[model samples]
Target: MLKIKNLHASIDDNGVLKSILKGINLEIKAGEVHAIMGPNGSGKSTLASVVAGKEEFEVTKGTVLFNDEDIEDLAAEERAHKGIFLSFQYPVEIPGVSVTNFMKTAINETRKAKGLEEMPAKEMLKLIREKSELLEIDRKFLSRSLNEGFSGGEKKRNEIFQMAMLEPKLAILDETDSGLDIDALRIVANGVNKLKSKDNAVLVITHYQRLLEYIVPDFVHVLLDGRIVKSGGKELAHELEEKGYDWIKEEVNA
Candidate 1:
């Protein structure tokens, strides 16, 4: 559902253009889950941001095509309106706004963008209950402030909860596994798996294979130095786990 071709991007650091993603080429078909593994400063998150149409980063070359249309000129919210969901690495906390209210506003905004009337209150409540239960979230949790005082797992799960509610066609999870304990990780991954289907795609950017153990991607891609250096089946994740990225770096430099 998403295709990226020779994508080069850079960020302005105090007015100097610092290149990050260089010549990134990838394609994610519908119903497939893809994992991107890379070391620090390897442009993993950059790739995610560029795809989500973040404003800070500029695309110097190439194109990001969603379904069949190029999305280079689309703003972040417009891209979101088009069913591109990006889960942030660090989700912001809104202390005064309750989770339920926040989600209600967000859903309504997206609907308004689509020229649709607001969803009925009854339907919204039903959806909230179903999605929270699907992720094993307590109703009490929903009444609390959004991401406020939430544990790492709670924050990640809340993002997944939003994902469930929005039902985006392409969900880009940027390091969703960060700071999660094993049990928390399982819950998050389980929620993700439950949401997967024949029409949606997930792009998981992570540093470890443990996340893959739970999500079980169809393809494992090793990204190094702003480019995807290797691609393989799920077993490649295990190999990276056992051997670390050193071997891949060695091979790349050889």
Candidate 2:
């Protein structure tokens, strides 16, 4: 459902152009889960931001096609309206806005974009209940302001909850496992796994292979130096876990 061809992205640091993603080529089909693993500063997060149409990073070349439509020029909100959802590494805190209220506004805005009326109050409540249960979130927690003073685990789980409600066709989870303990990681991964379907895809960008144990990926890719240097099956993640990124760097240099 998502295709990127020869994509190159750069960012400006005080007027100095610094390249991050140098000629990336990837294709993700529906129902597939792809994991991107790499060392720090390998442009993993940059790729996610570029795909989400973040304006800070400029695409020097290439195209990103979602369902055969070029979305390189589309704004970030436009991309979200087009079924793209990005879960941030650090979820921001919104002091006074309850989770339920935030989600209602988001869903209605998306519906308005599609020329649909607001969802009926009863239906919206039903959806909130169902998705919260799916993510194992407590009803009381939904009313406690979005991400405000939430623990790391709660923030990550709340991200999954938001993803569940949005039902985006493509979900890009950028370091969702960051700062999460083993139990929290398992819960979040379970939610992601349960949410997976034949009509949607997931792109997980992580530094460690441990998260893969819970949410098994169909493909594992090694990204290095602003480009994807290798692509392999799930066992590739195991190899990286055992050998570290040095071997991948050596192989790329070879």
Candidate 3:
């Protein structure tokens, strides 16, 4: 459902370009989970941001096709409306905006784009309650400002809740396991597993194999120095976790 061909990207406006993605070619079909594992500064997060149409990075080459349409030029919100979702590594806290209000706006905007009416408040609340329970989030969180004063684990759970609410076609989770304890991790993984379907796909970007044990990916890709140097199955993650990324770096330089 997603195809990225010969992708390249850089940052900043002065054209002092440092390419982060070097000729990336990847295809994520529907009903699959793809795990991207890499060391720090390997461009994994950059790829996710680029696909979500984040404005900070400039795509110098390559095409990102979503469901057969080139979406490289689409704005972030436009891409989101097209069913692309990115769960950020660091979720921002918006003071004064209740979680319920924020979610309602996002849901309504997405529905409007699909030519559907806004979901009724009663239905929205019911869905929220169900999803929150599944994620083990307290109902009181719905009344608070998004991510405000929430613990690290609570923030991650909130991100998953938002994902459940949006129901995007493609979900890119950037470091979803960061700062999560074992209990929180299990809860988050269970929510993701429950949400997975034949029609939707997930791209999980992480550093450790611990998360993979909970959410097994169909494919695992190793990125080093801004490129994918190795691709394998679930065992690759185990290898990386055992041997660390230094060997991958050596292989890349060789």
Q: Using alpha carbons, what is the TM-score of model 1? A: 0.98
Q: Tens-digit lDDT track for model 1 on 1-254?
A: 89999999999999999999989999999999999999999999999999998899999999999999999989999999999998889999999999999999989999999999999999999999999998889999999999989988889989999999999999999999998899888988998999999999999999999999999999999999999999999999999989999999999999
Span of 10 residues, lowest total lDDT, candidate 1:
179-188
At residue 182, give the lDDT of candidate 2: 94
Better of 1 and 3 by lDDT: 1
Better of 1 and 3 by TM-score: 1
TM-score of 3: 0.97
lDDT of 2: 0.94
How do the residues 19-72 of candidate 3 rate in per-residue lDDT, one tens digit apiece?
A: 788889899999999999998989999999999998899999999999999997
Clashing pairs in 1: none
Q: Write the per-residue lDDT of candidate 2 for residues 1-254, one digit (tens) a residue.
A: 99999999999999999999999999999999999999999999999999998899999999999989999878898899999999998899999999999999999999998899999999999999999998889999999999999998899999999999999999999999998999889889998999899999999999999899999999999999988999999999999999999988887899
How does residue 32 of candidate 1 score in lDDT?
Answer: 99
lDDT of each: 0.94, 0.94, 0.93
